[model samples]
Target: MYRWLLLSYPRDYRRKRGAEILETVRDTAVTHRGTRVAANLVRHGLRARLGRPASRTVVLWATVFTLACGLFTASFGTWLTWLGSRPLDHDELAVAVNQLYPDKPVSHIDRDDPPSVFIIYGSPLSWSSASDLLLGDGGEYSLAGLGASFEQLPADSRPRVLAELLQRLRASGWDDTEAVYSNAYDCVPDDPRCDPATIPSNITVYAQRGDDILEVSINDDSTTPKMSLALTRSTPWSAYPVGVVAFVLGALSGWCLFGWASRRLEVRGPLAQGSAKFLFGFAMVMWWAPILLSTSLMLSHHLSEPHPRWHPLWEWLGQPAMSLAFLCGCLALGVAALSHRLPADQTLAHP
Candidate 1:
């Protein structure tokens, strides 16, 4: 067990001090000493992986880069897991709609049948659509789902319909949550001028069975649909663990790579080092800015509605949609790597 834990350290560090570390661990192998030593080994091993032990700035930047890598990795893992789950087919969606409202066939319908499970501009990710992803229709990227709208649903009958639907879904082996009621418009809850009784509240219910989710929304907003239904697949159970493991691995990789670049550049001349810094800055801005923007927007959207199952992590990070930005960041990193070799004569040997 102690030997296995030592693998966390860098290859050179392990070769030099592996025996000494194992000897110390065995010497302190009392009831709880082994556990404590194991934890310390992992912590320090990770710290050793990032070379500048004396510089606090290195640790801080390493942490930031690691976290960014982890987020993107987790999103990618979640997206892969999503691909394994089944999408709602046309027949399945039709049946669900019919079951919900047998008397009234849904008049207006919108289905999510994108070329790819994760889509940008109704198509698979490609460089040709860079314009759409960045400036045209990036916001359109979303997971596949089925949606229907009822523009003429009577307000008086909404309560009865919702009640019956809930009872029916429950009887049919579907698990459900209590309906959430909130104002359809932007009304300040604490404002005396905004009368609660005067404002119409929307009704929303969420139900689940297996990996599938159903959302029923009844709204009173004049511009919005009167009633809407959305059917989508929930994130698979395996995705959680996969995402977590991917995040940890990605963080380690990011830290190690950053440390290598930092240490290598320290011995180089001004031009190479300066180029690396500028390229890294541009890459970070490209990669991280879209994540921040998309995360905020997705959070607000979820808060505005009753989202039983949140959208995939990639969507929140502005994935395939902002894949162009991610690609640009990668190119910058590649250029930075090239810059390291430009001034071979100025490079000095360093430990």
Candidate 2:
């Protein structure tokens, strides 16, 4: 374990000091010493990669860059995991819905075959949608799957009906948790007719069977009944480990690359350095803005609803939808890297 932890350090540094570090750890007899030493090694090794240990600014920027890169890699790994799983087919979803809610007949069934990556305008991504994805209606892109709209049940018996459905699900080999209740939607206090008490609360039940997840929602209004069932696939167990490993590797790479750029630009002329910084800052904005925006929206959504299967990490980061922005960020970063050069005086002196 000690020897493996040494890999956290840069290769050259590990080669020179790894044996000494290992020997010291071996000599220690403290309780839980391995855990403490492992944490210390990771912390110090990452810091050592940043080079200018005294510059807090470098550390801050490196951290931000690392997190963004880590999320991207994690999102990629998650998408790869999704590719390995099966999508809920139309016929299968119909059968499951019938078994789960026998008496509550569905008014309509909607089948959406989402792309392996993302859906644009309720369809697979395409060249025509490229304009919409970036400039026009990118916000419409969402993770969609099978859905069924059930005929409304009597308002008074809604709770009893939902309880029966939950019981049926458990008997059919589905694992479930307690039902979650929340306001159907935010009430408008200013409106004269908007009485909060009269509005029925939304009841949601979540269940999982193998890699599949089922969500049953009951929302009835004064004039009409509204209920729906949605089916989605769950992230595989392997994706967690894949995300963790990718995050560590991405963070390390981001720190080392940022350190290299910091050192290189330090000796350049003022204009070159300034340009590089500006471009890098723009790249960061392009990369991180969608993540921040999508994260807030997704967070609110999950909080307001009962989700047996959380959306993929990439959706929260607004990937594929913001693929254009990511590409722009990459272009800006590449330009920053390629444009930096040694000053003429240094070049002459070295030559």
Candidate 3:
């Protein structure tokens, strides 16, 4: 076990002192001591990679990663804005009255603050004495393809409208819809969180027709029932901005650590800043490289042939490929750095 752990260090470090390290581990065979040694080994190994010369491939991939990340982040907001601005599929309300809405007049409200149900938009408390209000769950509409109708409707009326919608959806012709009940549809049937069994308060129905899918969830406890209509074609582009933000923050953190390691080496010893920085950056961002590279490859492969179902396989390989590339990169750079550095501070190199 310690032999494998020592292998985590740069090959040069191991070559010079592998036997001595092994002897130390044998002498101090305590489990906690072994864990501490493993941690130090990893730290020193990764740090050592930062003082080496990088190859052309390393520099090329690093530049690609940085530019691709920068471009994706820069354009992510625009993508989200475009997605938000997409024109909703507005069919004749007259035709949809029996299918989606009640036979009541839809109240006019602000475009940003639309109604939850087919009828009026008001708080349940505002008119609690009169009628049951239907409150629209603003986000559920985005998923169900309801566009944002429920936002303005009275909360008490929500259950009534939701139940009506569900009944109509179930009665509609579903032969064509069943053939295309895909994961792309709204309120995904396979979504574990949205499972009807989990939400004991809600009576749920999922019905698909043509490009439209309706998810009616009437919570027995809450006056408002969640109803959503979804378009299968409307992909989840809304998630782009969020993913871009997370990717940027993670990449930035890794880049900073790499820079710090390289800078420290430059100040303390004879380290090649140019190559070390190149390799370190490459290793740091290679986690996203598979995703970036595979997307194009998959697209091209799809266009050339017809691989609609191979996407999951490629996605599965992305993380593992990233980890392997990063590890190999670190080891390669570590070997190069140790060989190139002057012998003046060999002691410093050990740490």
The candidate maximizing TM-score is 1
Best by lDDT: 1
Q: Which scores better on TM-score, 1 or 2?
A: 1
Scanning candidate 3 in windows of ten residues, the lowest lDDT window is 176-185
TM-score of 1: 0.78
Instruction: Give lDDT tens digits, candidate 2, residues 22-95.
Output: 88777762655767777887788777766655677878888889899889988788777766767657787888
Error in Å for residue 248 of model 3:
20
Expressed as tens digits, the lDDT of each residue in 39-76 for candidate 3 is 77655554444444543343344344454444444344
Better of 1 and 3 by TM-score: 1
lDDT of 2: 0.78
Model-by-model lDDT, in order? Answer: 0.79, 0.78, 0.44
What's the candidate order when arranged by decreasing lDDT? Answer: 1, 2, 3
lDDT of 3: 0.44
